[model samples]
Target: MPSYFSLLFKQDFSDLKAAGNSWEKLSRKMHDAFDTHRTKVTGPLHANWEGDDAKNALRFLEDIETRVQIVQTEAMAITKVIDTTRHRMEQAQKDLRAVVNDAEAQHFRIDDDGNVRLPKQWEEPQPDESDETRHERQTKEALLQDYQVAINRAVDEALRASGEGQKALAELDGEILDHKNKQMAAESARDADKVMDQLGLKGPKVPDDPKAAAEWWKGLDADQQREYATLYPGRIGAADGLPSDVRDDANRLSMEQELNALQRGDAYAVPGNDDRLHNLQTLKAELDKRDGAPESKQLYLLNHDAGGDGKAVIAMGNPDTADNVAVQVPGTSTTMDSTGGQLTRIGKLQDAAENADSSASTSTVYWLGYDAPEAPLMEAANTDVAGPGRAEDGAQPLRDFTHGLRASHEGERANLTVMGHSYGSTTVGAAASGGEGLDADNIAVVGSPGMTVDRAGQLNTDNVYFGQAPDDGIGWAQGLSLGRGPTHPDWGGTRFETDTSGHSGYWDDGSQSLANQGRIIAGQQPEEYVPPGQHNG
Candidate 1:
């Protein structure tokens, strides 16, 4: 039998942790010194010095600054790795000891040598030993087995991480040496703005197809990717085929730049800037509100813009790192001004999904990236805003967004659920019915107007889900001008029950609809979710 955490409570973890802390402290000191030199020494030289001598001195100073900053960055990264390894090791040791102690309390013997032995008394029970005693022993044994499995996995992970961290630390000196000696000259001469283009990394071929897009994205190295995103954020931010996290970062930087330009240009005061300024202010307010909210600390701004009525996609958690991701597509009349309410709706779904599976994490994104119809109360509402015009325009973008999520995802594959509500459902359906499909695992619609497809199977997804409030008047428009409602008996999709809160009430707090949505997103068994009409009984 292998030893259980034989290295537990060892001095190596502490030694590594101390070394990491010292390195980080030293790195910080070096960085601070470089900053002082740049401001005090280099600043005066650049202003007062003359000709070639001054130019050479300034270049040397810049090189030293870059080198110091690189070292600081690497040191911080190494420190993080060491800290992670130490934490894992500490937790593993604790878990192993707890398992052994618990087993000992249950009348089992676990020696200091890391041997878990069955009690001698239980090896051959007396004839008088009660059936209850046997049952208790059996339960205890099963519990011990579970604990053993957990600790083994934990120990393995900790050891692997420690080894990798040590290797990385060992290689850092060589890496720094190469950067200074071999790459310094080229890096110094390289134009920051034209680096991507010079390296043949500029103007990436963004394919319309999602799979092709993923391939294009995967081909770029870290440096190339960073440069492309930084230099041409506007194009990359709106590009459909890029990864979600990458797009998110680029979009955020772009948004800030756009806001600054708008402020500088006095956009609100300009003749034709009313729409753009209004959109920008609304988006800014929504972002501020979300940022200020305590519950939204983990939220990430995936995308945002001030173009045309404005577009935004905000995730309550990192979609790239989550085990499950739900994209909520809002319907007609949804704009940048309405984003907060949409965010709230999707944020509730985020919590619900995480709460349903306490062991896992979920991401919910409020997708206002499309130009939704501007439905008004006038008689032309049905033919204008409620028509298929906007939905058709948005179908391709919606498909690309889902595909981008899949391309950028890390770790295990996540369950991707695309949900459409009202006219938004029509948009989802249009995309799903297209030849390329929406690239989602599950397709769900709530209070759908129509999906444009005749049947659920046309969605090209593994599972199709539908929910509708009994009194939802939106369902009445099914088959008239929109697509067929998924809940229709002929639609052949699974129906989930929702409350009587009418249209847009499916996501209401404490509602059955919300619970079922959570269950579906978590990849739980269908039988676990309560279907429609089950709440009354």
Candidate 2:
């Protein structure tokens, strides 16, 4: 009898044992591996065949193909890393959600030594409840009266920031508006001056203080005396015999001339010319304003780090609500921009998350800054993704992220949630595996190639959420092909890869996959609709 396990690599030993064991025993092992992330078999061998037998050639070729798949995924991961930044600037309802978002998520644990453990339980998010329901639960757990005191402090800061920003903008607006109005007045003054000069009444036209100026201008210096005398000769010449009509005309013209002169600013030029120039300036200013230069919109930026590869942004339009948050981490080819890119993707991802749930909060954040490599990520599905990024370069980055989550204050997660897409999810898993250091409640993983660890429980956070949008191509990239070599062996991610939408579908245009994302961004939990499609057709 041919033994089914007789012809494979040592790593395949568990598979052989399973083949020989009863279905129930094998199922138990599988369950343990699924929930606990502990497994006997990691994968088939990638080493060079020792034997010259031609039969080995078939398997060797298969392994090469697998490696190629891993490499091909590099392009997708690379794009994700570079564009996650430059997201919108909003204020997080930090105070409200802090109590729970940090600690309740269970991204951390307390070891006997009293140190925070990074990962003790994975974020096993159940897709059954809507974001609103999850938010209610999170809020109930986080927002106690005592926690409100602490939250008040954070809220004060946000309010202060918002207030100051508003004040600055208001002042600036006033200044700009005042300038514009002043320019308009100047232009009108110039026009009045022109009319006065045309009438040959170059004296004060419209005095700022009409009554006083009328009394004062009644008298004049040599030039004014001569000019006014000419304009109203009979009235002034015969001091006692002043004509009422001429006096009235002179008074009106004098006031108009005064106004025109003031508008011109320079008395040297005829009042008309000054008015024309002022008007031109006003016109030019209005035109400029009508174009793109109307007003410059300012941006707000925030980042927090826990010494290691943990990098993230704390921003929200409304975190107190059931908002959505996306924490993206890169595998290889990452840099500061990688952090930014993850955020930018979150912004683009808005459409996807919104599609998941129209009524959920849509606020989101991009969390980057892991110890992942700067470049040279895997290129194909068959390649070893864990070796370069997770096992080697990205280890610390992953640690810091999870640790930060654990450090999140517990019992005040009024509205704190997270979505880890692709390599970013792997990063989340790594943080959870640390045994202590994250405090997030709900976590979502989409298009993840691999998270390396054996179990989601090790990833820490309370609710472990996963999204694979059938269209996400990461399945082939993350999973292995049996004929190609081995099966796609994630610690517990096979369940997410239920469709063929490919790597990008997790956030495709208006895809319901991320509808709950908006909810999470608003500090709300994602809706639990496993087999997650409300409209996936």
How many pairs collide in each candidate, listed in order?
4, 117
What is the C-alpha lDDT profile of model 1 across 114-175, one tens digit per residue? 55556776656567768899896777667656755765666676677667556545543414
lDDT against the true structure, per candidate, is: 0.68, 0.38
True-vs-predicted CA distance for residue 533, candidate 2, Å:
15
- Superpose all Cα atoms of candidate 1 onto the true structure and report the RMSD in Å to 1 decimal: 21.8
What value does the lDDT take at residue 30 in candidate 1? 57
Q: How close is candidate 2 to the true structure, as a TM-score?
A: 0.34
lDDT of 2 at 17: 32
Off by over 4 Å in 2: 1-300, 304-325, 336-341, 348-363, 374-385, 388-411, 469-473, 476-500, 519-537
Q: Clashing residue pairs, candidate 1?
A: 450-483, 451-483, 452-483, 497-532
TM-score of each candidate structure, all chains considered together: 0.60, 0.34
lDDT tens digits by residue: candidate 2, 21-76: 33323323332332121011112121222456633663444333222222222211
* Candidate with the greatest TM-score versus the true structure: 1
